[model samples]
Target chain A: SQQGEEDPQALSIQEGENATMNCSYKTSINNLQWYRQNSGRGLVHLILIRSNEREKHSGRLRVTLDTSKKSSSLLITASRAADTASYFCATEGETSGSRLTFGEGTQLTVNP
Target chain B: EPEVTQTPSHQVTQMGQEVILRCVPISNHLYFYWYRQILGQKVEFLVSFYNNEISEKSEIFDDQFSVERPDGSNFTLKIRSTKLEDSAMYFCASNRLARGYEQYFGPGTRLTVT
Candidate 1:
């Protein structure tokens, strides 16, 4: 696994179902952020959680960080067809000077 | 909402040719960065610029690559001589804070080298 690696590289689910993606990293980070990317498009910022923060939420997205476990999870509840996109978790190292190391990303498909 | 904008959505250039991918980050953002995705691969960082200078860069950003904020609004990445493997989607991103903040990315410039 790389610095940031997301599990379940691909996921498919019903429109009203929930989607959960997990990410793990090896190094200590100052903050972790999730991004959504439609195929061949730009990245959309989802949420950011600092190392000291355990959880954060925005709209239908919930992000949890467990630094002790070096892992994070993004849960999209009551997902809709428009929620279909690739989700990536990126880490900013404590001393990396704004460099964001991104995970391979989980390809999510919400079938309506 | 303010968003990052990039130019020439698609650029096709021959190997060894010079190509500059342009970007206009959010007006209020202070930090700028360049990243690239080689097709199905993960997005990789290229460089981060702040205060009109490069703050950090990745190993992949070699001598052939250079970044410049020629003016107040535009940030550009110039690949002096393109390589076959240089074919990838280049994304420009910006953020208001140096850390603990989300970065906004542009639609990306797909550079196809032949």
Candidate 2:
């Protein structure tokens, strides 16, 4: 399987604290994407970092990619209670098209 | 502000019964995909469809599994003779082009196979 794995499978933090999730994959990738899923809801696209890019940010979410290590990280800064969700990292393999292999995901809980 | 939409948010069926999960992807996107999560596990890719045919699929998408566009706006995943292990959340997703970056997903359909 080309799927990657995520670390810190579950996390808990107080509101306003920062939450960071890490993902590691085995193969060379064209791009990596981050997604957030609220309980029992659809996944919302968070960010996408191409292989050539090292870092990207959107609103309170920051994503970093290091191709040499085959790893990526997502940082949610100043997280609110509503930020609680399961975050996954999906990789688009160098040769694959249209299908993305997803990580197990990090379950984040922000307590108010 | 368009998002993917799925019908029959939850389904309960007996083993050996066939069930079809329906999805309406974002209007302009051309590539469509189906993924399933066996509760507590990683989301696994089932299949990808484009230009009225399958572009790619994973091992999990066996002979019992099939996908179709059927029309301009709807994409569907059909499970034939579902087994107990088939119980999972099925998610429908789409992106603008191949390589499938930045996909938009529909609220998954929870399938309970009894």
Which is the leading candidate under lDDT? 1
Candidate 1: list runs displaced more than 4 Å.
none
Which one is best on TM-score?
1
Residue A70 Cα positional deviation in candidate 1, in Å, after optimal superposition: 0.5
Off by over 4 Å in 2: none
| TM-score of candidate 1 chain B vs. the reference | 0.99
Error at A93, model 1, angstroms: 0.7
DockQ scores of the candidates: 0.88, 0.81
For candidate 2, list the clashing residue pairs, or say none.
Answer: none
Q: What is the interface RMSD of candidate 2, in Å?
A: 1.3
lDDT on C-alpha atoms for all candidate structures: 0.95, 0.92
Q: Which TM-score value belongs to model 2?
A: 0.97
